[model samples]
Target: MKILILKRDKLGDMLLTTPMFALLRQHFPGARIDVLANTYNAWVIDGNTDVSRVWSYQRVKEGGRIHWRAAFAQLRQTLALRAEEYDWIIVANGDASHRAIKRAAWLGGCNLVSYTDAKNSHRKVNHPLEIPRQIHEARRMANLLTPLGISLPEVLPPLRFQLPAEAQTFANQWLAEQGLTPGSYITLGLGARRAKKQPTTEQIIRWTRHFHEAWGLKTVFMWTPGKSDNPMYPGDDETAQPVLDAKLPWLVPFRGPLKPALGLIFNGRTSLFPDSGLMHFAAASPGGVLGFFAETDVSPAPAQWGPVGPRARWLEAPKAVSQLEDASVFAELESLLK
Candidate 1:
């Protein structure tokens, strides 16, 4: 069987699709599975045992109606995908954008399955799975496999991110050069798609100080430099500067690329984040993570996108990070450490 998975999204969205890949392999052991993912998120699907190959989809807006250039570009890409003659094409994640429906149809497969919350999108696909509200995102993707007779676990497995051997070597050398011990340091991911989700620099400083004083764990800050040109959570580096400028005794700065940063996360005692890509990264890691998420009536809550793992914990605020208290954050960290 030849199967194609269309999961072209950002880090968390891409990572959440890993369970579906595993389930597909379990149901159809001999099937050749290919994944269509964004250039940024291609790494998440890469090196997976279940996926035969990963096709890069560079243009996030390719299927959208707004830009003719992107639509034309998608047409060209679709021609190549259609040639593969996949027996089944599954659109694992769906936005309100009509582009997802357009892209799925354009790929031209024998059986096309998709999940969407929109009523209009339900009419366009062969199998349109209506996603349930307030469930973890991974479970929503896993629901796509029900048509194939795959029964998923009550608690889906954590997102999978495989770092290369070089990343591990780089992390070890970087930590050694910084005079830090492995498993005795905490990593603070200081990037957020929205300013409201980000905890103040003062909050980070105070928490780091507490962890340092109480647990003797030195803190390191990591961030991705957000670029305006990128549509998907370009990330912000500015959040890290305040912590650095404060020259806090226990704080260290180790900002760089994603894979190597993930290597450091793998070895760290624990990490903290504010609904950023790093939260997903740390959730994929073996290390513990405390994620702070803010949701209003319009936004999805922690119950929907919270981290999943034995050691992963999430604290939800009403509308912004400012609504969450510092002591509550510390208490969560203390509990995670225990």
Candidate 2:
């Protein structure tokens, strides 16, 4: 048997679909399971044993016009995928749209499985499942497997993110240089794609001090590595500068590639983040994860996108995350640690 999962989305969204990969491997041990991810998120499953292979293409931004070359490349890749003649092609996203369904149909699978909504019907999907409303993203994705006789478990499994050996080595070396050990510190991620979701610099400093004074754990500060002015990949260099310049002994700054950063986060006691991709990465790791969400009309609510795991917890602010009181955030962290 052969299966192809289309999860060509953001980093956090890609991580959410990992449970589906594990379930597929468990149910069909002999099946060749593969994934079609995008360049941005392919690393999430780089060394995952459940996936036989991974095929990736550059993802064009939504509503942005695609260059002719990029469009041709995508067409060529899609044609190649169609040639594979997969037994099943599952659109792994929860709210698969009409365009997403049509794209999966082009993949030429014997069975095309996806979710159906008002905009998209079952006519295109050989096996269609109704989209589950206001559920964890992982469980919502697992619903698609019902057609193959795989039932959703009462509790979903933890998310997966495999760290490469070299990345692990890099993290270990860096930790040694800083006189730190695994689980002795917290990873503090200071980047959020949205302005309203980010905590203020004062809030960040306060949180770092609270971790040290309350939990006696140092903080390893990290941020998206780039200039904020870059339109393609806006980062938190400017936002992180003041905190980094503070010269706080308990705070160590980290700046590097995503893989090694994952290594550091995996080794930490826990990771604190605003609603961002790094938060999802920490949730997938073995360490504890705490995230803050600012509910907005354009974004999915915490009910759907919140972290999932015994050690994972998220606090949603009624308005912007900046408005969340330091005492409330600290209280939630204490609960998470307990």
Candidate 3:
């Protein structure tokens, strides 16, 4: 049997659906399990034993109807996917993967299912079952298998990852070259796709300085390719009016490690970021993580199937969900570090 899971979204969201890949493997055992993700998330699927292949697709939106370009891409992908003779395909991303769903069904199709909430998305197919939006997405993803006779495992499944052999070596050498030794170093992940979720430049600087001074750990500013340098943290009139012009290193350029950089911090290398793949990578690894997720109400915990382990401490604001206060964030971080 062959299976494919399609979920197209942000890095953090992809991190959530990984557990379902494992569940499929457990239920089916001998089948080829795969994930059809986006270009931005193909790397997360690497080092996974459960999945056989990772396919990437761009968001196909046009005319408020699936665009012709996107449709062509889907036709090519689905037609090729049909050749694999898959027995099942799980569209975990959203109702948007409906194109894949229909195409897969038309060409030597398979058992088709998708994860969607009637409250948030329209019912585009026959598989979606309504579930709580914030009820630990990983759990919900795995639960999707229960009705299908896939027995639930006893152990708390984790979103798994196998650190690339080369990356592990690179990380070791990277840290050594930076004069960074093992122990409890803090990865000050301070990048976010939106300004609202990210702290103001001044806030980030103050947070980094405080963590370094208090913990004696090095600060790592998480960076993403093509993401413009964030010189300012988010501020608005209706919300917390950020105190700026504090002469801080808030707008500091990313002068640290390189992408796929070989570096680790205090025996407990950690990362702090506003919902990005780097942060997820840290979470996916055994390393510690302090994740600040705003905008959405998703959980920080990695999928319960992957090799990468648990999220040490996840801090998010309540309601409208972004814009964390310094004092409150510190209190939370203090607890986690201990």
Instruction: Write the residue-wise lDDT of candidate 1 on 46-73 in tens digits.
Output: 6889889988755634434366665676
Clashes of 1: 0
The TM-score ranking, best first, is 2, 1, 3
If both were scored by TM-score, which would come out higher, candidate 1 or candidate 3?
1
RMSD of each: 3.4, 2.8, 6.3
Judging by TM-score, tell me the better candidate of 1 and 2: 2
- Candidate 2, residues 1-338, lDDT tens digits: the string is 99998886778888888888888998999999999877878888988888999988776654466667766888999999999999998988888577678878888989999988777855658798878887878888888888888988887666777777888999899999999999889998865877678788788889899899889999999989898878778888888898888889899999887888989998998888888778888887777688888865667677888887777888787778888988888877787676
Query: Which of the numbered candidates is closest to the native, going by highest lDDT?
Result: 2
Return whichever of 2 and 3 wins on TM-score. Answer: 2
lDDT, candidates in the order shown: 0.78, 0.84, 0.57
TM-score of each: 0.87, 0.88, 0.69
Scored by Cα lDDT, where does model 2 land? 0.84
lDDT for residue 16 in candidate 1, whole number 0-100 = 77
State residue 199's C-alpha deviation in candidate 2, in Å.
Answer: 2.0
